[model samples]
Target: MGGKGHIFRKKLFQVGSEYKWLGNSGELKEITLEKRTGVTKELIEKRIKLVTTGIDYHLGHRNCEHFAYFVTGNMPRSDQSIWHMFTDHDPFNIQPMINNFDQLREALLRSKHCGPVGLSRGDFENAVFVSQLDDGYYTYHLSHPLGGQHLYITTVEKAKNFESSYNSIVLAYFGAFFGRGEIFSIVRQLRGC
Candidate 1:
């Protein structure tokens, strides 16, 4: 997959069932209304809240317009929407920084699937997120709410049967996809608390 570029399928994979924050406030709260209603609109609103607040807790929203505000130092027009930016731009080639991260993220949302390009499997209900990165193999986050996220960076040979708690995989082609310091900074900046 090296040189081929990362491919993010537009069809998002429902890795796990967990409650993510609603908005940029980093409040880490989930609205029960959406849960009870199970409406796509309500879910989309919840996603909007998460995007507007600029929280980095969800990997799927990392490359969003709000994420771009801090990364590129360019605030998008209020008239524009997160879906427009996130599902419109290409995120793979674009560096994963505050500046260009949004463009890349937008591209990801536009993709049929968003990821480093790899395969993942697990129990039907409890799925896992896995990615094969250049630097090391990683698990994005496990499905369901479980404490202590796990990342396994091992040899390619071992990667074939790679098993992890997370369902998000960071493919090797991305080149050390997830950086601890960068993510920490983004989370801290977005949280703004």
Candidate 2:
């Protein structure tokens, strides 16, 4: 884990703070309070309170960044190593789950935007996935598959609620930590697709 990244992300979540977003590509962007949306101190606190028992922000953020990188393929380059620290910790048994991504995708299709998440038995308990349809509505799940040793899909609402406690914290942390301009740049690039 990059010591600099860990310290940076930690400071970003220190409450009432600001920082410049530095991309892994070495691009620099400014972040400020006036420009950020969908992220607030209240939301952070609320989400922090919702995490499952025994889970803390440290562990939760690790899980969140790992999943985000897996899905987005972006290594979160904001001078924050929450992403790096997350991977270093290897919070989830993701290595084994890579092959399971197909199973996850298939389960997602069957559930029609509601499931394909939740804890299964063993090291591969927790999971997360996105659900979207023709409607503008979209939701993401963080859960453990139910029953058996193999993966299964649970409802998005449940997964979302589960993630609300900590996953939301990580999202908000990155959003705030990276600031508005940097986020817009990334979002715009993503939308161009």
- lDDT agreement with native, every candidate: 0.32, 0.31
lDDT for each residue of candidate 2 in 1-193, tens digit (9 for 90 to 100) = 3111121332222224655666567665555533343455565555444333322223323444443342233342223443453223222222111123343344333332232223323322243333332232222222223221222233233334544332322121012322323323222221211
- The Cα error of candidate 1 at residue 140, in Å, is 4.5
Task: Return the lDDT, model 1, position 45.
Answer: 42
**Number of the top-ranking candidate, with TM-score as the measure:** 1
Each prediction's total of clashing residue pairs, residues at least 3 apart in sequence or on different chains, is: 40, 12
Candidate 2 versus truth, CA RMSD in Å, comes to: 19.7
- List residue ranges in candidate 2 displaced over 4 A: 1-18, 21-37, 56-193
Estimate the overall C-alpha local distance difference test score of candidate 1: 0.32
Measured with C-alpha atoms, the lDDT of residue 101 in candidate 1 is 32
What is the per-residue lDDT of model 1 for residues 111-186, given as tens digits with 9 covering 90 to 100?
Answer: 3322342343442124333333343433233222332222222333233453432333332112122333332232
